[model samples]
Target: MELPEEHSLGAHRRVSEARHTISEILTRSQNEHFAKGNDLDFSYVSSEGGRFRVNVYRKDTGIGATFRSIPSEVPTLEKLALPPIVTKLCDFHQGMVLVTGSTGTGKSTTLAAMIDHLNQTRRLNIISLEDPIEFVHASKNSQVIQRELGTHIPSFAEGVRAAMREDPDVILVGELRDADTISMAMTAAETGHLVLGTLHTTSAVKTIDRVIDALPVEQREQTKSFLAQSLLAVVTQVLVRTPEGHGRRAICELLMMTKAIAKLIQTEQTHQIPSQLQMGRDLGMQLLDQALLAAITARTVDPDDAYTYALEKRAFQKYVTDTTMLSKLDSLAPAAPVPPTNSTD
Candidate 1:
């Protein structure tokens, strides 16, 4: 598939290499391939020293692979155009901070940047658990120990469980993929370690909901209580093309754990949290629509594209040239969401 120029992930062209050559690349990238249908994700160091996270697998037709380049240097918050609120989220000594988004939405990159910031400025020891680790960090002000899934550790839950015993001041759970991992990470947070993690959720409310929902039905309230206490913030983002169509930038929403917000979470009143965010602007809270509106104002994103990610669709209607979207938002009894298109980014 030919990726659009505005694609934030990678690869504009389809693979044209010979099957044997592609197979060779896959084999050399990872010593041994997984079963035909299973994706083997591993990082590859090119002969020239560039890095890429590759997924090699087989499909109905034949072998298939996808490569996402990894920069040798991890970007700083300033470089990513992230608000200072994100850096502040990293400053907390203890609590859980989640950087969330769907696949290819730059959650991993954002996490790496936050970790890079901690690595450069803090004196604490940081431990990271990743699958096919992307960016590599060298110890600077802080000591960083990165463990790969199936390499140094068995699973994220086990890795996080083990990190607690390792005297770590900070833990990075690459993916909060299961219930045990989420619960353990929260436990670590409650015990005075700053735990950072990622989820496939697209909003702060949904992110909180997902955590509680992932637990057993009987454990939801307890998990909610723990999350209300331990969660520091949730920064959710999406990368979209600029109106000029030259490049892409991340639009993010941040929710700092204020007392009111905490109370709402503790009581499972999550749907009303967005109102708290809007009122807590002076306290550094942000909403996805607010971010999207800002991006539209700054000419950083196309109006139609921004509309797809906007929670308050009416807010974006003025900017969008297409009146049909506005009609969709207004014409329904209760407006339906304007869903986003599929993007590797």
Candidate 2:
């Protein structure tokens, strides 16, 4: 079958290679079936040092396929270029650590990195429930039981409940998408299991709000209280093109729950949480713009890219400007004169 050529040469070559690999998988196994024919859905490691999640389907007279590339080797914290504050989440023994970002911002990669760290260094039973099983973990000091959503069980919520019975030390849920899944994850954390999950949100405050809003109005208050007690930290990230013009890097905003922050969440005063995060830098908390400014100053990301991802662009702009500009502005402003109203009074 003739496949449509991709626009870029790089993309075309990758697609061609993926197609060849898919064809091989379809023909090699007799037990595999797809679309009531010889087609099959399978995953394999690509020759280019990445993993592929493939779907083979029958089209107008031939077989067509789509492949999603997953990284072959799990990236380290340094390699992923995430903030140092993320490592702090690993210190928590049990609680919900949410890695939140918009789609395609490397949330899955970050989760995999954390799991890989625990798998290699710590002796624990790790249970992972993924939609399509993106990363394949090799058991080291820890044993990993990876359960694909459809292959192992029916849904994420069910898989999570089942994980509790499996006697796991760490549980990784692909996404906390619905209230059922979120509630299950919180329960797992509350029961002394370390729960790690991802969410589709851009800021820590919004992530907290999203979880609360996901529940019914009557349950919202109770849900917030549970979250305040079970939530450990919220890491929000965005990927930006590097200033070096080669690849992308992540800009992360970290929000670690303190007593004050927990009180704010319980009271439904989430807007104040961001300011608390900004003020609590000593506790590994940071606002999104602060991360962007740091990335810009380090030359790891382009100024324009940083500005684009910044939550408060004007504040970030002022932060990135030279001291001379601040000095000039200060000099141009008039000083206040002493008032005679007090003496007259």
lDDT per model vs. reference = 0.85, 0.82
Number of the predicted model whose TM-score against the real structure is largest: 1
Model 1, 73-103: lDDT tens digits are 9989899998888888878999999999988
What TM-score goes with each of the models?
Answer: 0.86, 0.78
**Runs off by more than 4 Å, candidate 1:** 1-33, 322-345
In terms of lDDT, which candidate is strongest? 1
Clashes per prediction?
Answer: 0, 1
Q: How far off is residue 89 in model 2, in Å?
A: 1.4
Stretches of candidate 2 above 4 Å error?
Answer: 1-50, 54-66, 316-345
Find the number of clashing residue pairs for candidate 1: 0
- Tell me the tens digit of each residue's lDDT in model 2 across 148-219: 876787889999999999999999999999989998998999989999999999999999999999988998
| Residue 172, candidate 1: C-alpha displacement in angstroms | 0.3
Pull out the clashing pairs in model 2: 34-39
